[model samples]
Each structure stands twice: as structure tokens, then as C-alpha cells.
Target: MKQTIRLEQFERADIRSALAKMNRGIERESLRITSEGQLATTMHPAALGATLTHPLITTDYAEALMEFITPVSTSITTTLAQLRDVHRFTYQHIGDEYLWPLSMPCYLNATSDIRLAQFGKSHVGRMKTVYRQGLTHRYGAVMQTISGVHFNWSVSDELWPLLAAEEGRENNADYRSERYFGLIRNFKRWAWVIPYLFGASPVLCKSFLKHSSADLDFHELSSGMVYVPHSTSLRMSDLGYTNKEQAALKITYNSLDDYVDGLRRAVFTRSEQFADIGVQTGDKWQQLNANILQIENEFYSPIRPKRVADSGETPTQALERGGIQYIEVRALDVNPFSEVGITAEQMRFLDLFLLFCLFTESPELSIECQQATEKNVNKVVLRGREPGLTLMDEAGEYSVQERLAHLFAEMAKIADVLEAESSAYHRALQSFAPAISNPDATFSAKLLRMYEEASKIFQHVGMRFAVEYRDRLKNSGYEFYTEADFQKMAAQSLAEQAEIEAQDKGSFGDFLAAYFEQALDKKKRA
Candidate 1:
């Protein structure tokens, strides 16, 4: 069966109207418990934002969205404490727990335009990841190339539960639980992402994606997850769900039978499976989308290369052949100080911001675009907000701060359209505009202001995380660290790597050359 996914935009009437209707169910308070198992009475809103809660969604007064407001929260504070406060105010739903440490954002089919965010057909092998050992969803599985554009809606369908379902919080006479969604702005360490940025992926993120109840003749099952023997490797071709012919003829994650069926399920009639016609994203929505392109540019802020085939082929011809069709947008910075993670204004702005990326309508970068990206990165790092810091023109030609100003003005107009649609989205847009206006609003500057220096920021956040983890483990009566955890894990891992390298029997450059050779060979075979 042939399957294609499309980004589905909702009409403003439908989008806003649905949100408005849903407003009746929005909770204004949090519902969490103290270690004593009694309600924590003496707490501030920021306290609620920082608390770790379970059961993803809730209507409890202790962990409600309205309790954390995104409507009117903008400040010039740089301390992690303050940033954390605002973040908590925005994303009380996704607290520090439940953080999935994956290199890329979990791929969620948002509007049809999201595919455009990945590029129509410019990403291929990027979609699939292969571990040195065979696995599909862990350290080395294909991540559906989804880099996030900050200040936008979340990009995961899994969010439906947190946003719509009240998981726990039963037996409260004051209120009834309803499906509720809130901003999720917890900024966790991104070790999973470090490898990707360093270009070590399709090699790391391939572990288990599914669990089978039992083991087989080739492998044994343990702890609900199928064990992958260390002796084997899972190739990219092994993960392709393109069609039956490309399936590797062997099931790795699940039994061959189960794998084949799962593939069918993910692809066949996928349109029907994703049948939730978004409430309504109308003309105003499109206006808000395209307009975001004019104002604040966010995509240009982050660096991520979209891997395309070196072979010369027209975009049209490549699409026909299912060639390079991937681009991962990685500009979003973790709201490093937020309790909840991020804020509503950030989310709303992001919705428009992402559309802007998709609609940038850019093709292959001219030397100019490449240089522009380099210049922007430099400016962002050192002089992000030095009055009239310079940037490139839309044509990627001349360098001019006036051009940057002009771009900002145009983007502001788009943001205004978004503001016109819903007070929620509009307010969110206006709230974050100041940050976009200067470096002070960016996470980096705020971080500097917080600790009074870069090193201090790291120490403070690091200590905070360390303290939190210690407390968590202590509370759970668990071991936080051991000799193996501290030292042996790394030593053992490196030793294992040495062994693998020894068995491969190649020099460093030779290994890289050999890897490419095998990759190309596999591609040609497929």
C-alpha cells in the first residue's frame, strides 16, 4: 500500500473556537502532593511550576494551566530562577519528569506544513538511524527528523493525552477532571542531542522501540524488552518501512510477522488513522502562518544541516525517486530556567514561527545564504543584541542592520495576524516580542545575566539538577550512584568500543572510509 502524510492546517474559526470552547475546562490551579502526602498549602505559582507531578494530565487545582499564566508574562530578568519562574508559569503540564532524552524532538504529525518543515523530499537516510548493534527506537533508530522551532505548538501527537486527558486526580469534590493542555517548558539536559549536533547519529540512537512478551530461538526476552545481542549490527536498511521489498527480509524489533504488520499499520490508511481534522485553522490561521515569516525570524538562529544526496538531481526528479527529503530545524533553545519547561506565548509564537520556516520558500542556498547563516551565528553568539547588529538580506546578498530591522517589521506584521486570531495566541506573540527584539530575551543572554557569567550559569543549573536528582533518589530510597555508575560505565563502554574497533581491524580514517563504502554499497543494493 502507498502512504503519504500531509500537514493539516486548521481554520481560525475552528482553531480559536475549539480553544474557546475548551477554555471552560482550563484549570487555574495545580494539583500536587508534598512528601508528607498532604496538599502543600504554603506555595507560590512558581513553586507549582517547579513541582514534579505524575500522570501527565490533570485538572487538579495544584497543577492547572491557568494557575500558570502565559497571557501577560514578560520580563527582563536573566537569572535561571526568574527564567524558571516564567517557564513554570507557561508550561506547568510537562514538569521536569517525563523528559525523553532523544537527540531530535519526538516526531509528531502537526499541521500538514510540518512536512514542509522537514523539507518536502530533501531528507532520506536522515529519517533512519542504525545502531552499531541492532535496535530500532533507543540510541540508534530512525528519528523522524523533527527539530523544533521554539515559540510554537508541540510537534508530538503523544501530547494529545497530556493536553486532552485527565490521567489522575480522582476524588476531588471541588472539581471534575477534563482533558486539558498546558505549556511544557522544562529545560532538561540534552545529551541525546549532543551526538546529533556532533554528527554521531544514525550510529547511536538505535535501541528498542517495541517490547515482546517472549523470546525466540535467535534471541531471548528479558524485562519486557527484547534483548539485542551485542554481536550484531542494525543497518539503516533494516529500519526502512518503505515497502515489503525493502524490509531486510528479517524482523529485528518484533518478530518478522509482527514487524510486517506494524509497518502496514503505520502506512496503510494512515490518512484515516490521523483523522482528527484540526478544530479549525482558517484564513486567519494561514495569515498568521505566512505572516510569521515577516517578523521575528527563529529558524536562522540555530544550526542544523539537512543531509541531501551529493548526486546532482533536480528537486522534482529527486522527489519522484524518493530521494533526499529531510531537513531538521533545531533553533529552539530549552527555556533553561522554566519550571514547567516553556511558556504559552513561546508556544503560540512558535506556531507562527515554524510556518515561517516552511514558507521561507528557500531552495539550495547560494553562497550568500551560507555566508548569511555563518554571519548570523557569529552575531547571535557574541553580539546578538548590540543595537544594530547586522544580518543578511532575504536575497542573501548585502549585509545591513536595516535589512534585519525590515525583516523584523515584516515578521511583526505576521505575528499581528496571529495576535488577531486568538487572545491566547496573540498575547503569547506580544509577550515574547521583546525577547525577539533583543539578545536580552534569548536564553543565552538571560543566562549570562542570571549567573553574572557563563561559567556561573552552568554551575548553578548543574548543582540544581544534581541536588534535585539526589533528593529524588533519596526520597525513592534508591541508589543515585555507585562505583560502576560513576566510573566503570564509561570505562566499560570504552573498552567495549576498543574491542569492536579491534575486531573491525582498521585505522581511524580507514574506518570512516570503510563506513562510507558500506553505506554506499547498501544504498546501491537497495
Candidate 2:
């Protein structure tokens, strides 16, 4: 039977007090490419501090790709303001290099042209680089270049204790962790709504399809852009980060222990396909190992249970020590229209949506339900706004509009508990209603129309957005971090990086062996 949750479970007076203290953080990733629309060949800017040690600014898979992280804040407005300050500060440092405004890359000549992010001579630093080497060997560098935003969210500590009291349970990490897992399961079931509303990458440069034998029915425009009509986010589809090897792993999220066990096994178990590639060709190291995953972070998912790791503690170890501190939402595309790639309205809606996931009574997800969820997500990513589209529930198939309307209605109840001014959340739902009724109002459809009107020149549109965003940031002074604050952070990060490099006394080979053994030992102890 489908689980049902009553609104009366959260009486307004009690829930309203808790809602006012929730925390949120955002991590946005963007590729830094040159002015003429070529991938940046330059090293990460020295002015930006060490990528390995910097708290706010860091490099992702490629040296050219930059990721900006905001410190956790209770106010949604404050988090976004901090993100904008990071952007403004970064713009001052990256001379002539434009942050790619869209989720997809602008242009690429070859895979070799993209450089894996490099770190200095620390054992940990080397491991980070070697892991990227594994990723490039496992998946092409072009796929790694695709960028997106990650939203990290959590309720206040007081709120958790209140929830535990209401449930007549112990206010401990175990209870909180289990509840967070329930939220994760519900997110998996309903997260299709995210991509349907915010998906922005409906098209790609033809260069991305150069080497692969992907059988996408791409329609080519006169100016050389390829797209699948009615597609919402090609970035989330098979053409982007989807891998058959990882898919075969069947990672489950029914509980914290089950999820962690699946991830642990995948990391340790060697893959024949990767083994054939070999870990080393003579003296040079090829990858961390021939395992399905080099580390826990490599197990990509739409959402993850997160805990702030202690000094020298692994991600899994942190979770083992203290249950989940927050959940990271990874499904959002970089909204091309916004200067900072995300807006206050989007964040507000996300807050409501995540709360809905938490409040809803989530049933234990069976393997069949898991597969159904995947199907629904795939349908939304590819053709969400197609006229009269439908998604499957355990009961049967239903129209997407009907499903969304029901979801919005539930979300409104959450909004009331949040004590939010109804406009932001209400307007978001109302605006999305049109996309359900008419496809052209969707981000993908509007983007495609822009491309058509611009004579099919994708680069032109992308470049225009890039320049406009750059100027916007350049003109706006820092709202959160000051110039002195950035300078201090950069210097501190450099010192930390140097100290780490100096502290390393073991060979890379020995370090790798110990890392794997330690993780295995932890799992056994648990």
C-alpha cells in the first residue's frame, strides 16, 4: 500500500518554530574556457589559492573547471549572496577566461586537450590526481567537463530533537540517520520534478559527439548544433554522465547500512574492463586501482548523505562516527539565465521540495520501485514537457500534470509550516504549470527557440550570456566576503598545502595500499 502522511502530524505552531532555523549551502561548478570559446589551457589561477586546500574555490575533474562552494548558512538569501561574492571575486582573478554559463561545454578539439586537475606533491594531493586519472580512463574527459550545481541542506539540531520526540524515539545519530535515509528514498521517488522544471541543457556542440558511437537521434541545425527535440536535460540523459558499468552495480538506498555496504563493495571489487587497462604501464601509474570505484565520492548519485569529515578522516569514516549531517542534491542543471547560475526563487522552491520529501511517509523502496523511479526520471530528463506526458506510480500510470499538481498541493502545506510568504513558492508552482500545459514555456523549449532565432548559432548565444554575466559580476562589489578576507583565505590555503606536501613521507604505491586497507578495516569493525 502507498504510504500516506497527514498534515496534522505537523501542527503549525510547533513546526513553524522549527522551520525558521534550517541551514542550506550551495556548490556550483563551471568550466573556465578561453575568450574565443576554446577550453582554457592555463593552469588554475595562482591568485585563487591552492585548489587542494582552498575552502571556497577548487577545481573539479579538469584543471579548467572551477567549483565555488558557499559556507553553510541559515538564510537562503545569505547563501546566494555568498555565492555571488565568490563569483565576483573569481571574475577579478580569471583574466580573459570566461566561466561557461551553461552546463554543457562550448567547444572542444580533442580529449587530450583537456588536462586533469593537478595538485602538489602531498600523498593526499597525488591521490586526488590519480583518482581523476582513473575517472578519465574509465570515462572520457569530455564527459567529466559537464558541470552542475549541488545543494546541501539540513534542518537545525533543535528541529531533529523535536522530530525524535514527536516520533517517540531516541534523539540520537542512529534515529536521525534513519530519518535522513527515509528522506533520501522519498527524494529518489519524486526528484524527477527537479529536472523537469530546471533542466537547461537541451542542446550540445557537435564536438562532444566526435569520437563516441552514441546512437542519439540528433537533429543538426545549419550552424552546427545537435539536439533531440522535446529533450529537457540531455546533460542528465544517457549521452551525458550515464555509465553502463555503474548502472550494473545496482546501488540501493533502502537504508544507511545497505547503501554504505554497496558502495564499499564496489570500491573494493576489481573490474575486468578496468583491469585490462592495467594500473601501471612500466613506471607510470594508470589509475588508483582497477576497482569499480576509486573512492566513495566516485559513486555518483542524484543525492548523497554527507557528514563533515574530521581531520584525516574518510567520508565513510565520518558517517560511521556521526550520522548524516546533511544531504547533497546533485540533480540541478546550471540555469543559464541566472548570473550566479541559481536564483533565490529556485533555492526557496528547493527548500519547500526537500521539506516535502522529509515530511512525507516514505515506504521502503523495493527493487521494482527503484526501477520504476529510474524510468520516471529518465522520462522527465528526456521528454518531460511533451504534450500529455505521463509517469508511472506503484498504482499505475498517471499524467505528469496531475502528478505535479498533487505534489505542488502537498508542497503548499509545507510552505505554510515554513511561514514563507506564499508568493515565492506559489509563483514557482504556478509558473511551472504552464510548462505542463504547453511545452514551449519550458527552459529547454525556450532555449531551442533562442537558438533558432539566432540562426542556430549555439556559441553565439552562450558567449553572449558569458559576457553579460562577467560584466554583471565585475560591476557588483562583494556582498559577503571582503577583498581582505579573500586574500587571507588564499594565503592560509597556500600555507596548508605546503605543510601537507612537507608532511608526506610515504611512496604513492604504499599510500594507495594503506588507504584501501584502512577502508576495509573500518567496514569490518563496523
Q: Rate the local accuracy (lDDT) of all candidates.
A: 0.27, 0.84
What would the per-residue lDDT of candidate 1 be over residues 319-436, giving only the tens digit for each residue? 2233222223233433334333344554444444443332233233334433444444433333344555444434444333343334344445445444345456556555645544
Query: Candidate 2, residue 232: CA error in Å?
Result: 0.7
Model 2: which ten-residue window has the lowest total lDDT? 517-526
Q: List where candidate 1 sits over 4 angstroms from the true fold.
A: 1-326, 339-344, 360-364, 394-409, 412-421, 436-438, 453-461, 465-518, 521-526
276, model 2: CA deviation in Å? 0.8
Candidate 1, lDDT over the whole model: 0.27
Model 1 / residue 420 / CA error / Å: 10
- lDDT by residue for model 2 over 176-269, one digit each (tens)? 8888888899999887888888889888889989855677768987767788877888888877776577877878877777777788888889
Which ranges of candidate 2 are over 4 A from the true structure? 1-5, 420-423, 456-459, 523-526
